[model samples]
Target: MARHVARPDPRAHWVLLLLGLVTLLAALSFHGLVSAVGGGSGPDQAPASPAPRAVTTGGPVLRLDGPTPVSRRLPARTLALTFDDGPDPRWTPQILDVLRRHHAHATFFVVGSRVDEHPELVRRILAEGHEIGSHTFTHVDLTAAPGWRAGAELSWTRNAIAGVTGREVTLFRPPFSSTTAAMTEAQYEALRNAAGSGHVAVLADRDAKDWQRPGVPAIVKAATPQGGAGAVVLMHDGGGDRGQTVAALDQLLTRLGTQGYTFTTVSAGIGAPDSMVTATTGARLSGTALRWAQTGADWLTSAMNLLLGVALVLGVVRLAVQVACAQRHVRRVRRPRRRLPEVVAPVSVIVPAYNEAANIAATVRSLVASAYPALEVIVVDDGSSDGTADIVERMRLRGVRVIRQANAGKPAALNTGIRAARADLLVLVDGDTVFQPDTVYRLVQGFADPTVGAISGNTKVANRRRLLGRWQHLEYVIGFNLDRRMYDVLECMPTIPGAIGAFRREVLFAVGGVPADTLAEDTDLTMKVLRAGWRVVYEEGAIAWTEAPSSLRQLWRQRYRWCYGTMQAMWKHRHALREPGAGGKLGRRGLPYLAVFQIVLPLAAPAVDVFALYGLLFLPWSQLALAWLGLLLLQAGTAAYALRLDRERFGPLWTLPLQQLVYRQVMYLVVVQSVVTAVVGNRLRWQRMVRTGEAAALVGGAPAR
Candidate 1:
């Protein structure tokens, strides 16, 4: 029998989720990993080291104090103009266009990492006859940068510029420093370090301070010449908003042109060749690696964006559909039912037990206590080593029979009980499920319609004293019942759970007495009956108390079997999609929905989780938090509505938010694992959770802990 096969391990979902989590983290964490290996900064190129140490000495301590770092002002009437921290796609182009308007050429000192990201910008600079200078990788204040990193900063920028422009650069600018007067001890040290590395320290004679954004007027005033024949004017083409800098550029150019000051590259003013023979082999390799790492981050970020988009779309659709359908269902069920002929048929209740000694006696006793006048309870012991049969015998109750059988599965056990049953109405239940007094009577009411062959009952969780149990309880009420209300109204109700369902003996027998083929005997059997032209409806008023898995591990095993078996049954009956008559109704109304919402939606749900993590790590915390709260709110409202429909209390909804943190992820992954298992053609066995007799008190209406 199908239910007799090997069951899935409860650990399977965790293993699968763990593997998927690792993969997602890998994608999101790619930049960090690469940065760690290469000893570089992230995409934004923030300083790699902590804040610079305080240097008390004030005035510049560079070449002006001597002659190495700073070059003298060009011959009278000359000006060498330079911009720093540039190649920003947003601001750089604006600065370039402004420079173009004046038909002037200037040097742009580019950050190496930024160049790796926007290599074409470097090429554009060279193509425009603009000189390139090294701004150090990541814009670190080289003075305070560690020993291992300082050299790489300058070398990497030179190589990155050369890699794209095919020309080496000798002009260097120590970040946050200028000519002799403006340099500090740290700045002097950094400039000397650059000279040692064969770089000419390019310091400004005038500081535009455009990077400060002290208005266009302020920047123009700062750059105005001191009536000098030559000067090195400082400005910025990149970093933050450069609108003021760009606007101020045209003003400075006109002012300088009026004063007869000519603009030239930093090297020409210093009287050296603008280009060098080569960028070192090490620098080029570092640049290439940075280029590749950036490319990877780009791809991963794009993938995450795509995933988030799809998840958002699907999530919204689901929420809309569920909310709309649930509202309609609530209103419809609230209306009084038309009086129908009372269903007084005697019911034969069948409890199939396999190592369920824990709750067998209580379940049988609950059936015996049903208010229905005529009742016969039959307990089928499916070869339990645990004295389940002995427990039934100890009850010595009337109208109840125990049929001991070999170790066949649940379907076989149910078949045995059905055969031994003497009544026309049959109620099938698991050993762990206990019923209310009027459950059988209310369940059979659905049989009033001659076409209605089976009725599904409301199965509630009895062990909801813990957080996990409470989550399951919510699932039973919202996920299962809300779905049934919608599907039943659509005339395409699919599953009639094993815990509490009723069927006519004739219809049950026609379906081969509970089908032993699939692990989900209830689902397989239900669809078979539907295909056989029998109508199935859910009876929400017929309540059955069943023990829910109290631990995540147990829940994983049970849900895994349920999800996998459901996939198999869906595949087995897929031909219904093409059928013309009764099966056509199922094919048209039922299968597409099951395929989409069940199979497709679940497989893609993990993307929401992946995107959530990405947003936390790369995007803003506010974005991730808002998105999470919005989803949680949607769920909370939906859960509240479901509880109202089920006549359940609102208190359970308190746990709904926390449930998103863990329980929901587990369920999502279980569905994912099921899809993977089905796609790979793996056979899944029926898995049963260990039963505890705690449900006896719950059925007796004991207060929840």
Candidate 2:
């Protein structure tokens, strides 16, 4: 049973994150490029002279240099009405409905920007038998605008219009120009410039000044024809609240019909075929590029939304479930726990030391000062160059043994200590931890059931002077202790921290004496004991104070090792899930909880942050802020409850809110990098943390007051 087998390699969930980040960046880049390309021509295009209009006092004043057709003539009793600057989401639909209700066909000069924003409206414009044409891309004055900008203003809109509608737009309307006779120097120059390009310029014969939002009657009077040869009336369906425009259009159409006049599209009224792009400009490539760009952007946006939704639901549900279970355990733990047997057997305490000279004395002294009558202390120094073994040997304390060996690892050192011990009950302690006098006695009492293989002791951080230390202290209580309550109640407690835990000797021996393959040997061994048919429980009364990492770098490294190692152990023991019976409850109950709360939830936490940023930029920031505060309050409540249950003071929890802002994200990044490294086959070496001799001071001589 002590023989070990090879474990499975890693899974590549890390790729999902890599791909997710890459694709998200790609989507953002695509959007930016589309914006630049849609709204601008190349910045290097040459400047051009001001556009010239047909102003000569000649017959017909026909502008031959212009690319678009100039038409002011029409049949009798026929009105050619044209709408420009459209595809406005709010007003466009109302205009479309009015056109549909009145059975009218009018040309809409759609702005490229609005088309991109509301492509559905552009489709509706085309679907409703209306002619679509360019409105200078962004309503810029083409006559004074640079030739390159003007060129792109015309061409990009045509490309985009085609991109969305699969139809070419050839009709052009110079922005800020009203009619053939009523034109400014720049407007006529713009007409000449646009005609130099391949677009037909359409000028309205009548201006309603609807954009000024003059009263409905004024707009009607401006647009109402006064018994003339067919006229081209200009009204707007977009750019602002077109309620008055819609009303004015309805009134003018009723008045015109009563006067026996018919409405037609601009192209029809101008004696030209409907405008459509029949030739490709520059977009006729493999077609895959645009499709891929669109698909990737769409997918990334959808994924972000999905992540936000899932993270919100899972975070809330897990918090609720864990809190409810913890409360139940609190009520049950208040009931008197079972007492250890009358025969308080002899016990062996193992202190694994590796370059721990700064703190070994406190560990040995705490164990030696134990109230239990029968106790033996073994200090296993795994080749500590810091004179750790020498310190223990120089103490010359009775029944204290020192074993020196090459630097293997904590697991190997522990196995050596187990072999040297002569007692059936064992306690394992890290060299930096200081235990209470009665902790060992309190710890072993859980094994009174005979079936209980191991008991986990409550480990608290002794160093809490720094902000990081305070955050860790809060985490130890709220995250670790509260979680242990639920795990203990479930009978599937997985880890017996190396800081302070007692195990029955035979159970440890049966489970292969701490395999060195995993970083979290303690967790690996505990799961082995469970699979080997042994029960594990948490004993909070057995308390020890250990030092936490002092800096963010140290904290990151410490957590990386722990998280990566725990993942390894979880993967290693995954088979236990298939086994039936009460002993496999660790696999059935404990594993799922760890997989979710520890692994999956932490991995998905970035979604909450990402979504928070997304909401800040695009969604309702006030609601997002409220949701964040609610989660923080929920965490505060949990921390308070755990502290009360542990008999710990709540002063450190003042930093809890700050922890959410900074410390929590650091831990999340640690988990993310750890998972990425683990999946990518990056092996992590075991390194010792630099501990300050501060552990003995904060918890010196006895338990904290």
Candidate 3:
């Protein structure tokens, strides 16, 4: 089981959140109008009630055409509390107790599936005089493909709930709160047409992001509203975990009760009446509209829930991996080497060159000057049309060999060099990368330990004068280094830096050389080595420096490929994830951890995206303002800590927010794309980022003075 960490709410700008109610109302009103006018059946004809209008005081007024809600005038204090998306056995009862204590009536949009398992809860909800609303069968987000499945979902839940309550349910809340103009129109028409005797649709005015697992404070903050306005605060009684939600409601309701607030049922507040009408006809109609509405509503609901399930699974998977791997530690056994070994085995340093014309010479020079005993620098030029390889050839360095090849990509080039290597060990470096004089010595020394099959070097951005470069520097220090340490602890280092990584020649051969099919050869090789029972070690002292992408666009592309490649590698080794380690119980716990923490997390991130936007658009101003302050402080802390780690970089600390604004979403997008690709079985080929000549052109302001 993965450790659960509550994600901070995204409504970071609490002070600026005052307009949420107004925005939500406006959106609701706009949607209502668009649906009603655009081919809607008749004005809501259900038991007498006023026309649906988005209002601050009241929740969504359902305007039905046939057997639809009859729009009638009502007082501002006439607010109906509507909860959607649950029948959570864990939390729904707590919400019920509070409502019963307050003698307040509300509506619960129960999921169909939940009602089937816990029939008593649905019966109790209905028996207690709280109106019941359909939130689809599975609580699926209706926005996904195969939108028609919602009909079955709705019918299933409705029948289950009715079986227990022996009462008909009329209201419907689309899963994910998503309703298209077409779907809404169809749902309204279908509901009224299907209305039997007396059933009405329930809509909400206010929404609390209880589904997101916000803490009790944040939940209360969102649920409480501005207090002055008579409002229907939306809460969930079901779907996933709602423990915090149930607990928060008790506090919110009690506090509000002290302030003399009250709640009412939709039927009672709107004034019960006989028979609903088709909104279009404003006259009694057949049950056809009601059935159509039910069908459409169900399909829509199923689509939404399906999407939500996929998202949830992704998050849970990542969480599982992170938790499982967090405890295991990989022992780092560094061999002591005071001097170079005698008869110095010839070393082949393979540099996979792309368009590195500017830095190729310098990179080659660094390799030539390495203080190793015997070394052979093989620069496999991966079809760089630029003068990169030419410059290396012109240098005529004694031990350096420039091998020109067609543009077969990085993995292929590395494979070529490995096949040709005559040395005992092979060092792979990117063409644009430059290594320190002592890097080879430090890297080779680790091989003295027979278990250390391959070794990774620390990567630092060579140029950090620019803000982007500086931020990248901090990222390497805080993000990469921390990750490396964590992976070292787990004994499953999943990726070796492509800039400079050394491997035993035999180990490379055993893994069938570098996998040519994957975009991330280094990551693929790392997993393969671990799977084959070879241990990977990290050389903290064997540092290599290379240029970092200078702009957000460049960084996005680079990181995007990395993420996509990671997913590909994860897919390749998924079987190993379930394999037991030395014990018969579990083969490799580390693989599972990597899958959950690194591969599965990107999909879960979308919840934060939705929370951020919704909070800005719907949350109360004060709470929104407070949330923003909290977010800012968190960002500030992250920046300060990151900067402290890489104080040598100028703007790394100051650029944290900017990085979140420009870069974070890109990362999220890449993660999302990776998930999509994995599901669709799309193959990712290696695509190198174009190197800017600036890093090489940069003259020393002061080199490690």
Candidate 4:
């Protein structure tokens, strides 16, 4: 009894995958790993506005919320050292070492995202008797950002700090801020909002400009205060190479200490209380979650990038191997050599039909018109409801016979046809395929060498008037035929396509007459013949035209069956890897090639598109476009060469790019579904395509009366 096969809908799995991808991209944007939508910049480059003289000249710390806005200057002979855009793993530690050696205390205004990345550094700053302040998350300019963004930035930084050290900070420094005298109105207004939230805005009075990486002397000169007046010096520990900042800080600290200058935290310099406070439990929990979430997103993005790179290398390597091997095969075929004896042996052609009434008459007539001297045609109708056998019988073509059987499937029908055949050599043809007059003659010529067990003929897509048809035509020439040449050269040809293939009658019986265990009977039988130690070769001169699916749904079904069946066949012949002789060659070479290029590469192919979308969103478009174009051109060159080898027209090459966008994706999805179905141990039924008589129309073959 046949086991019942269940078709499972995989829509839910795909939906979940899409949602997860979207969530990851959103996380990356939020963490500033990718460019955020509408993200604003700092106020450093903005035009200056009128400023309050007292706040500008008096102090670096200000309180703007009280009825009387006030500013207090640092004590005489004292300096408050502040670093922005940290805590970087590199440079920050070096600067801290210098401060530790000098016994100087300073403040670090940390970006929230970086705080999450290096929480231990934040904790160390607080432990070493230094202060921690908010530089706003992602270092966005509070003055230029939307009102809500300013608040969120400050809040997120506070939460990140609280999560790391169990404390909250009230000291805040807006990114790109400088001396109060240079403040724009937008900067002042942003400060007022911070004051409303109980934040002490800390602006620098002396800009060290070490971020420019100027000489250490320049940074020292800029940071020093004239005479004994106290000042707040600004520098950076992150955002780029900060070698100069670290060196300048060490020298500046020594010079100031010798001048009887005292170093203090930002709050203490102005005689204010400590800005750090214990964080709420809720804040700590929320911030920890946010930190881990960002870390996971970072790891995932790294992994995806690595996989994309590996897939690219594999794809390129496969293309190079195919082209090189194909060229070698072409050279060998074109070289002058002694010709083999002409094969005049009688041949039997087997046509397996199931609901193929639309094309059976034309199929039989084409076979009857073969140029071979002695030929017999057999049509096996496997319980076709459309009277396929009756149509063939009415043709009354000479030496053609029709046999009826219960619908036992294609493999069984082919076996029945093999049992009825009388000739020593046999050719298998699909019911919807139309053969050229010399196809049989050329296909049988391979049998002149008794070592040849089977010969695979070139199969072309006949219905090439439509875009879908043209795409398949290109695939046949470029993907299938080119690969066959390479396989033939390697002496491990895998599949003799059902559209047109010839086999010795004894070789068929020796391989157990078309194994019915797998959906891909052709591939299964071919592998069996190879494992039996008989050589299989490809005859490029024999051409058979067959109809390709015209609609997307039909194409999907047909390809899904093909992919799933091929996998099943591969699994069945897996032992060939360890076996000696020709089977081992198929296992070691042909199977691995199929597994990598056909299965694994297609599985990873979607990553290319995903990264392309990522590049469009966050990377330079010009670079991405050039890279994509280079790959497309490489593929086009390969396709052109394959078409030239097959003697095909270049007209279908125009659809190559569109095929990558649409048809290629469909084929990838088919492989994905087939893999998923196989993993779940689901048996797939044989899927038959609707006959359209397109093959007969293309070959100009008239139906038999």
Highest lDDT, which number? 4
lDDT digits (tens) for residues 501-579 of candidate 3: 9998998888899997677778988888887777787766787878788777778778868888876787777777565
Instruction: Report the C-alpha lDDT of model 1 over 571-654, residue by residue, as the tens digit.
Output: 888888887655667778777778777777667667656656655776668876897788788888888888988888888888
User: Could you tell me which 10 consecutive residues in candidate 1 have the lowest summed lDDT?
Assistant: 36-45
Task: Residues 381-450, candidate 2: write the lDDT tens digits.
Answer: 9999989999999999998999999988899999999999999999999999998888888888877787
Each model's backbone clash number: 3, 8, 74, 0
**lDDT by residue (tens digit), candidate 4, 595-682:** 9877987876665566566667777889988987998898899999999998877778889889989998889878888998898787
Give the C-alpha lDDT of model 4.
Answer: 0.85
Give me the candidate number with maximum TM-score: 4
The local distance difference test score of model 2 is 0.77
Please list the Cα RMSD from the true structure of every candidate, rounded to 1 decimal place.
5.8, 7.3, 15.5, 3.6
lDDT of each: 0.77, 0.77, 0.64, 0.85
Per-candidate TM-scores read 0.83, 0.79, 0.56, 0.93
- Order of all candidates by TM-score, from best down to worst? 4, 1, 2, 3
Point out where model 3 deviates above 4 Å: 1-345, 578-590, 620-651, 681-685, 697-705
Better of 2 and 4 by TM-score: 4
State the weakest 10-residue window (summed lDDT) of model 4: 34-43
